[model samples]
Target: MFDFVRKHTRLLQFVLVLLIFPSFVFFGIQGYSRFTGGEATAVAKVDGHDITRAEWDAAQRDQVERLRRQMPGLDPKFLDTPEMRLQVLDGLVRERTMLAAADKLHLVTTDDRLQRIFATDPQFAQLRNADGSVSKEFLAAQGMSSVQFAQRLRQELSMRQVLQGITATAVGPAGSSGTALDALLQQREIQLQRFEPKDYLAKVSPSDADIEAYYKNPVHAAEFEAPEQADIEYLVLDLEALKKDIKVPEEDLKKYYTENEARYSTPAERRASHILVKAEKSLPEAERAKAREKAEKLLAEVKKAPGSFAELARKNSDDPGSKERGGDLDFFGRGAMVKPFEDAAFGLKPGEISGVVESDFGFHIIQVTAARGGDKKSYEEVRAGIEDEIRKQLAQRKFSEVAVEFTNTVYEQSDSLKPAADKFKLELRTASAVKRAPQPGATGPLASTKFLDALFGNEAVRNKRNTEAVETGPNQMVSGRIVKHEPARQRALAEVKAQVRDRVAAEQAAALARKVGEARLAELSKAPETALPGATLTISRAQTRDLPREVVDATLRANADKLPAVEGVDLGAQGYAVVRLLKVLPRDPATGDMARLQQQYAQAWADAESQAYFASLKTRLGARTTEAAAAAASSPAAN
Candidate 1:
């Protein structure tokens, strides 16, 4: 079909004009305006330049791909969400802001500096060839060319200069962090006494009248109510179901195994050691010739006495990484070395020495020490794996073939799932008391939000019929019908009398705990040095002594001008706490921690200073995110 269109390109162009030109003429230019002005959907603006929806979408896709590569097992549905989109848009805006700052400041990295950094940076060592040329294969693998990589690196360097200026001048306030750290880590020797509601539970019991009174209160009505539930019947059509019906012949499996034989076989590896004589391509012609002549001498010596090759390599080899180990390159597959060196090494048989070979690095006398692998497994050894692979491939192919029919069947026969289930040879499963949201530990269709939403949709609930097939995951379709639905309602006092009584008792216990805690606080304040009944420990903002945050805050905020201070904390449902602040002490520093902490503090300060400067830059450059982004950023599902 494509070939026919390609051959009749002019005719197709004319036909396209006949079809689309009439619409434009009838609708005027308004129909095409949406495409021409794609920036109408801009999500953000940086330095007066609009970031079109297309650009934002492409960036989000790239970000999702990066995350998928990083965590292969992570569900893609979780990664490509509104929150993730907002994050990707923010990152794009930051980059654009940095670029704008770089342009405004005229901060451009020269080609010479780029080259110098690429040549000397250890982080890029793998991308550099022996003679300092960028590896074309590596760039190709990353889907970039030499020029594209250079442009990207140049832009990054220019952006780096924008923040580098601020960081270089940033320093934490001298002697202030120490004082602040002292206060933050200040230790208060105190006794922690907690009056827990659970301990007071056995001490209090509510009467029948008290239980009725508490149950009648409007504030506690929701406590006795149960969530709405539905009795549902669902059907799932996925790769597993398709695979069950797939049958592969023995001949087919064997054929597949033969076609992909290399995958079942280990790649051949060669372990070679070499005696390299320095003869770089950039060397003077006379010197390179001399180096080759010296390598030839070493080759002759190694071939004459093979046992002396290790000694020869140790003395003559200039490759320092392997010099101490007698030039042992270890086991390596093809393409692991430079073209010339790899060819010479692979062509030599085991225990054979190659003639003098000149490569980008130098002239080399190579020896093939040992070789292994390149052996394919027999049919029986890999039969089970091959059959599984064939079955999976067939199932995947079958899914696409049957997906449309499956969807149509569920929608056309909306009254029941039995028809579609029988047609697809899938089991129709049922569950009682299922909520609108997924229950804990739910799996398969039950856990899918899309399927759950479809199950409880208005049409499905009202008609008690099958829902339209929903694509819950990759190549997976799910459809559900509501059989019976239970509406949310409050329970009568008699049905929840015990629960109501428990709640009344808890309220009374909590009040009792609060009263006792307050009384103890007043008594301790009057007699500061009096003995307190609790565990003695040093507490601080950093060290809570197993106490609640509220208790820790109350203890630290208490008046400690005198020798001792008493404070009470209401811990909500957990009850109350009484603390006696005995004394204050400085934080104990770990050995050599002061210097490290100071350095960390300085770095944090530098980052804050840089961020503040960047914020000012954004203001100057007029950066803003659209209302669409602001609204979607707060979507509950985004986080």
Candidate 2:
């Protein structure tokens, strides 16, 4: 049939069955195919349902193409991994399964509906001309023919119909009350106390003999090795060294404040009421028609007596939460509602009922109960907001001018902050001990890693001279002179005794716990069912999906497996635990609290059934697949 399709001039017949049928099936299969290899192979199977290699390859190629478009500079080597290929294949398989199921169920979208959907799609419209026709070149670039694209769209719409049938019954209107939503929003505040092994330092004094014994342990000795250190000096450029020369111009601040006035003004808001009729993707044509008729009738009644709009909304609105309150939506700013609804609501005079307004959420008949006009704030009221904007703009201009002059002055004369401060008659401030970070007030406008890098560099620190000034932010400059220098060094034994003692105690605690746990495990091994009398073992319930915090803490603090039967391992300050695998439980759909889970499982089962039907179709049709497709079919990861 495909060979005939290539040779014959009967384009319509070739397109309808050969091209259309194969493309549909190919799209479904290709989602699970790998694109990289010269040949395709299978990665997964549902029962005897085979996902072919060519299909998997095609899917992978499509994904790679998309990724390349998004991240042009991304490494091509990222696509080389078996894991990456498998992920692409899995996504393809899932989509294929759903589409196959939709076919089996005879779920379909009509040509009229598909055309309507495409016509309204913004992407397609964006590519169309004023005459309302798509450009052939653009269609080619997107890799789609009108027929092929429409078929794909129909398949998508059909799948959506099936999905809606499954999920719609479980998910009520957005305003419907449910405890599950309440539970999801609940926040828990906990007070916690942490216990460190260092707290028991005084009780865990080890003798000289103990220290020598500990040194014998390879794990303990490893901690004593000195870390590698580097000492080198480089030229530094500090930002604060240029601060003395910075001075703001009065005219610049006034100009900046004038250019950005609206930012300081507050916009108006209005309180409103509305009755929304939610639109559903799977809503039957007849039902939609009936809804439209009902909205029109309601509008007629409301228009005849506009004063009763709120009362009618209270009785008939599907939005249960606001219905009782006459559909009061409360005060909101612009961009709060669907564009059409917002435009209608905001355009209305106070106490006026709007005509039927169409939006993604069905039709709405809005009434503006009130309106508030926008207000311009007084200069004094917005003084703080204006001051912040002015300071930022002025500081930028001043810093740029000062930085250049300060840089030249330091290089020509003394390379010290004192001389620069004196020449400019600026106050000099000293910083407390700081590492690589800038000290408060000493940072000035030009604080940055670059400035810090220059300050700690060879010429500035080692040669005892001021480095060049550096730019940190826009209109900000900085340079620094080192007032004091302190080299890194290890503290003497006396100076660090407290810290060393705490470290020694933690080591002792770990060693003691390990020794006790090992002995307990040995005893348990001899008599597997024997319970150690008087030893309390705390057991707690935990879900596989989510482990409790206390359980996680206990597991991390000690090895529960090493604890003797009925003997607990101490988990520092948290508590002690002795665990044995009681049972391994698989996920139970029946036990799931979520309403969506039941629908999800039903859809999954239906998809599996659908894929099986398609596999049989492939066999009956004798679809001649390439060797690459056969290889992909053999791989477990291939969907």
Candidate 3:
């Protein structure tokens, strides 16, 4: 029943499945469905806490917005489906489950730590000036307050930390390293003797009666159904017709270049070095105070001897990433460092030492090594870029105007391509010898459901007229007038005689092979030793890769279970195979190979452990999720 549901569920499409869940209906009646003008629905209940419909909807909107931003031209209707809604709900449920488990374990982020993380974030820092101050205009433009954005960052970071801790605790150590993976990688050389089906082909031939009998079989008849089709003429309006109409005046181009000159300029940059003292909110106050004093001492030394800043940094800096290189950060433009750190670094002259600066990472003693000014690029260097932008903008505007006119002219003229072509002075193009199925030239636009429906629609074909203009791309539209239509008919039997004969012969050969195999099996059952003329059944431990390369994949899957003592099994297109399992290898843990396996399977083992841990946690917390939620989370429309 589940398999059948999976097959037919796809036919409902992404949008319908997301929006039409049974849970939604249930919540609607109870006045708990937020999306349908009621109180928030409870998608899941984790440890007595409700995962509300409002939260699920917000998550879904966030996922959709992210995808829309990444893929600018994607259809918005794709997200409004039932399937997508269900997928979003399912994901929210899982997240809620994880959060519940984290809470039980007392895993959480403090307010101070969250504040430090936000202050250090590069994206947030971009909203500040060179003097370490936030710009109100930039904050407004991004549609977020400092406090609101900080809270969001904290939630995301806390969830990440909790998930990492869970996974780490679940995956302990690699226990199957020595025997399992090592023995699998080792090669075993062997000789092969193949029983080719083509070798037996010359000995088998079917009579006329055999062919007729095979064709009469219900299974064989079912395989020979005719292809379904539709025939009609369609009118198309294409934007390519407006390409020649677009023009970029010299005055406009010059004006645009002059007005946006700063957009093409670059910013000044600086090089600096620093000594860092690592500190975290989780550390004791006493320990943190000690770390701060150490940073102050380093700052004092650097201030007294500015030229020796690099030497002091190399000796005292706790940041391993930059300490080895004398804490040199290399050249950076504006907004490259944390607010407090960047402000101190940029304010200093070359070879000048700064007072202790505090950031999320810890305290920093900065030294300005050098500075470089910005330069304007040559006009010739940026001319090609400017021209390309102008071309696209002008082309879109011109195409939109001309397309509307073309659509109007086609509708007002006689019901044929000739009249529309003459009225608009268009060179009429024809699709010669086109078919119903997808083909080159007309296939792309014609393959759409709406376009195909319009083609076979009464007004566009029987009455003959232009179609309403259809938008295919940004500022691009198309309209077409039908010129001709052809009806479909079946070909005579004589024309398809060769195809029928080949099909009949293929069926006969397969049946004959099966019969021979059955007869051999009957004899083997009576006397197992007499199954083969001289060959004896060999038993040995083997892996999937050790099997004959030329063996049919279907034969392996079908006969694998009937092993250790099987005889004369038909292998379909590969004749037959006999099998046996001699011995089983137990896993070994202590060896050099175990070290390699531990390194290689570390990620896979971690994922397996994580899944097991999640399942165990769900059971412990008595977590229950609706079918609708699971479906919503897995749907393609959710993202």
lDDT winner: 1
Counting clashing residue pairs in each candidate, in order, gives 0, 41, 20
- Please identify model 1 stretches exceeding 4 Å from their true place: 1-39, 126-146, 202-225, 238-404, 457-477, 487-497, 540-543, 557-559, 589-592, 631-639
lDDT of 1 by residue, 150-172 (tens): 66666667778999988987877
User: Candidate 2's residue-wise lDDT over 435-469, tens digit each?
Assistant: 55544565442235566666677777776566676
How would you encode candidate 3's per-residue C-alpha lDDT over 472-531 as one tens digit per residue?
556645455456665554444445445656665555555566666566556555654332
Report how far off residue 285 is in candidate 2 (Å). Answer: 35
Candidate 2's error at 332, in angstroms?
Answer: 9.1
TM-score of each: 0.66, 0.40, 0.51
Model 3: how far residue 214 lies from native, Å? 6.5
Q: Lowest lDDT 10-mer window, candidate 1?
A: 20-29
Best by TM-score: 1
Model 3 spans with C-alpha error above 4 angstroms? 1-65, 73-89, 103-106, 115-143, 170-175, 182-184, 196-223, 231-239, 244-395, 404-468, 480-504, 507-596, 616-639
RMSD of each: 12.2, 17.8, 15.3
Q: lDDT at 244 for candidate 2? A: 31
